[model samples]
Target: MTDAYYDFSPLYRSAVGFDRMARLLEAAQRNGQENGWPPYNIESTGESTYQIEVAVAGFKADELSIEARENQLTVAGRKAANDAGDSTERTFLHRGLAERDFERRFQLADYVVVKGADLANGLLTIDLARELPEALKPRQIEINQPKPTLEGKSAKSNKAA
Candidate 1:
């Protein structure tokens, strides 16, 4: 990570536990490059559901692959070796379409899993949902009410006398 971002070095020396934050900062710096090839979109479908749409124009289903691991999602497309063919055999005067291979990575939140992916009409859409374990989900705890003590009941009887 850059030194301008809080000078994370002191976090390791002066702080007791901020290593995870420092590591995350480093990862962010590595992924901060502005490579705009193959545009994409992220939208919220539900309270805990999300969808990512990436333009895979010239890529086929077989040429693309998606994998999620350690809170990171990677989508890569590799064209076949013989797809373009020999220049002598096939030549293009104007090749505007980006048939070149590319890979995109996204940082996912905790408990976020890639449910499914579909390639349709040159668009690759990936569905994700946050599935928290039952232990982590909020639940109503039943608080037991204490029964009336015998001492309190005897005191009430004495007061009545």
Candidate 2:
């Protein structure tokens, strides 16, 4: 696969604290042509909440794993190899379903965290939430009125001498 280069110099020059976003965009463009396997979906469940659902047919709970570290979420699955002595020798005419191993990763934004995960009916759902720090959360700033000057008059006062 060919790696494509993009010029984000303009964005870097004009934007502040957006370096992570630019890096994510570049990484996505580079991997845009990769194979799609073990399809997944990301949905917003509520304010500051999200869910990721992945289809993992034919895979037992023991064969799958999910991990969250720093700002990355990774999901991996592997089916145990069948022992030669356990199964009768049988030839398959056609194999359509994919039971192969797969690994998928997602980049999470700042303050985003994985709350929990569950698997039901062959679907693996991962819950997430964004919890911003108190300092980062928006707050109303009080606009203080100007105090009276030394001349015994307020800045906004229009009393005639």
Candidate 3:
């Protein structure tokens, strides 16, 4: 994190409603090391909806945890300790799979909420949606239309003159 890859303070001076983005960038810069370990893909599933799929090859459903709070989503995985003498336990010949503990943080946009998550076939899929409030959604505004008058004030004045 010493390389200072992202310096967003300068843009903060003139920027409005972008602090969340800046924080996201800074968090990514700080957690650069843990960003690449668990490969993940973010795909748009619908209008204002998204799905994040993380490659958790050797993790079980109970070994993983997902939490969403304050517009930030965190997914973590931890391996269970091996039993003293398990009948089905076997030694790995080459040990290539990285089943190590890891944590991944995702910064969500405004009003984005985690709907649900599922772990299947070594892949974790999390669903999110941008549930914009009613006030923020587009709506029709009634425009007042003046009623037609038989004679306006200016016209009456001209007739009197």
Candidate 4:
């Protein structure tokens, strides 16, 4: 855990192309003290593919929403209110499972795109894949072979006897 008020001025002064990383670190530090609800896991399914599973026990498929915009992925869940009358309500002796609504966000790297999402049992899984553009992909440069020059060949050619 880091102090929420940590100064990043030194990092900014000595670094280049690291502004996004600094922002991410600052955001994490600021949200460090927050409670970890609806725990999640991020896993690499392939060389360039990933999956994020979040435990949303009581939330239904219809009650959850997934959105991807720019470089951010947001998942939110809300329990719908029951339409039944309050007269038929029953109290629980031990309510350990939390049914509170929650919203979770994940920052994605460049070229990473959300493939799909599925909710089954009590887990919500979001799939992602990285697709690099042709211009950005690594390429091999061909080295040209130099043409052989004719030895002793000048502006005047030697006459043969």
Top TM-score: which candidate number?
1
Q: Total backbone clashes of model 4? A: 0
Error of 2 at 9 (Å): 17
lDDT of 4: 0.86
TM-score of 3: 0.74
lDDT string for model 1 (24-125, tens) is: 776676567647778999999999999999999988899999988778898999998774556666578998998889988888999999999999999999
Candidate 1, residue 33: CA error in Å?
Answer: 2.1
Worst 10 residues of 4 by lDDT: 152-161
TM-score of each: 0.75, 0.69, 0.74, 0.74
Q: Write the per-residue lDDT of candidate 2 for residues 99-134, one digit (tens) a residue.
A: 899988888988999999999999999999999999
**Residue-level lDDT for 7 in candidate 4:** 89
In the range 1-161, model 3's lDDT, one tens digit per residue, is 35547578976777788876787777777677554879999999999999999999999999999999878899999999877687696788898889799989988888999999998898999999999999988999999998775565666686898
Ranking by TM-score: 1, 3, 4, 2
lDDT of prediction 1: 0.86
User: In candidate 1, where is summed lDDT lowest over 10 consecutive residues?
Assistant: 1-10
Backbone atom clashes (below 3 Å) for every candidate: 0, 0, 0, 0
User: Candidate 2 or 3, higher lDDT?
Assistant: 3
Off by over 4 Å in 1: 1-23, 83-88, 149-161
Candidate 4 lDDT, tens digit per residue, 16-35? 98877787786676457657
